[model samples]
Target: MILCCGEALIDMIPAPVQTGGTGYVPHSGGAVFNTAVALGRLDVPTGFLTGLSKDLFGEQLRETLGNSRVDTRFCILSDRPTTLAFVRLTDGHATYTFYDENTAGRSLFPDQLPDLPDEIGALYFGGISLISEPCADFYAALAMRDADERLIVMDPNIRAGFIRDEDRYRARLDAMIRRTGILKVSDEDLEWILPGPGPLDEKAGAIAARGPKIVIVTRGREGAFASFSDGTMVTAPARRVEVVDTVGAGDTFNAGVLAALASDGLLTRAGLEEIDGPRMKSALEHGARVAAVTVSRAGANPPWSHELSGPDPD
Candidate 1:
């Protein structure tokens, strides 16, 4: 099982009303949550670990996860309210105003973390969960705890605006990256992490030096690029599809990559270290294909195994 650790929240997206003005609609989202759901839909044995509220929005999130077949037994339930992010989409791009203070996901502590079962072969960490306080530290601790055993994957999905303290967030991220076996970042995320005038690979290499064995950078329509610790590099072009909204595209892409890795029996730490050019390229293509289906639809809705072409990941 690939156990994803992070936030599960409600995205209040703008919807058109018959009365002329726009109204927001609740959508089950959050980067880590989206990826977990996508993986489950792709027929991967997936589990999600996060702090969940008993609120109505939390119920929606739980239902969504259940429908997608993502195990939620590891979730820590609380009476705290669910975090809400009001989204504004400009030409299919999304920006968020998060109401996250004191929310269930943000209030999680290190002590609340559960012992993992041997079935969990991989552990994924990221999203706004890495930006907040005590919970952020808790996730960082979890990653470090299992760093030597399970395959650790992370996609910082950096949301700079959500970061209250840059210094602390950077330190936490740096520590997590050092333990991350596979690290996926967007073009914007790469820039923010390094922030300089240089070639993409050069910046990605700097990040690779920190510890991640494999580094993947997703460039929206241009596709994705990956560099391995052994100096092997591969690229995949984005799949063409009519635009809906970019929300959850990157998250779904991460799911595809993980699913492909698992399908090829490369999801283990040793397998990732031994992965080659052809296999790496195949994974990238698979990721792009899966993400295409997501962007072609609205919200963070991902395609089921039957909805995608070729064989299922299982």
Candidate 2:
């Protein structure tokens, strides 16, 4: 089972066609939430660990999770309201403006964490959780406390505006990277985290030294590249598609990679470190294929397992 921990919230997106031609529409969103839903759709045994509100929005979010077949036993319900994010898409890219200062998901404390199952093959962490307060520390502690035999995946999904302390954020990110076995980052994320990069190899090398066995750098529509601790490097071209939006492409890609790894029985800690050329390539290809499907869709909705099967299997 894969346990995805982080925020779960509603995203206000632009309507397909504005009446007056100026406003946004609402959709269910959040990084880990998207990943969990995608995994569930792929028929992967997935669970979500996060705080939800007793309010209507939270109830709706819970229903959404249930519809996706994601186990929500670890979800905590509180008096706090569910978080909200306003997403704006332009030129096929999506940006978010969040309103989660004191939302339920951000209220997660270390003491509230559920006892993890011994059969958990992987744990995924990302998004605003790493930038928030008590929750941030809580997630970091969970990553540190988990046995090294479990696969740990992280995607920072950095938002510069929300971050108050740069040094503290960098320190936390660096520390989290050290604990993660799989690190998926975007070109924007790299530029934001590590400025001025003449050679991406140097940046990838620096990330590898931080303890991640595999570091994936996504280059939007261009493609993605991966570097393994064993000195294996592979690259794949992004599948061409008429993109509706890129809202949850990265999160969907994360789901695809984890799903592929889980299906192959390689989502364990030892499995991560033992990944070789063929395994890494297959994982990356799965990620790319899933992401392509997401881009071809409207919202953050990823394809189901059957939808992902192509005429010619790679």
Q: Pick the candidate with the highest lDDT.
A: 1
Q: All candidates' lDDT scores?
A: 0.92, 0.85
Q: Model 1, which residues run further than 4 Å from truth?
A: 310-314
What local lDDT does model 1 show for residue 251?
Answer: 93
Give one digit per residue, the lDDT tens place, for model 2 in 1-314. Answer: 99999989999987756456757766888998999999999899999988899998898888988999999998888999888998877887888888887889999888876778787888999999889887888888888888476788999998899898889889988888998998988877877877984667568767877798888888877788888766678887787888888888999998887888888888888777567777777887888899889988899998899997668344
TM per prediction: 0.97, 0.95
Kindly report the root-mean-square deviation of model 1 from the true structure over all alpha carbons: 2.1
How accurate locally is residue 41 in candidate 1, as Cα lDDT from 0 to 100?
Answer: 98
lDDT value for model 2? 0.85
Residue 221, model 1, lDDT: 84
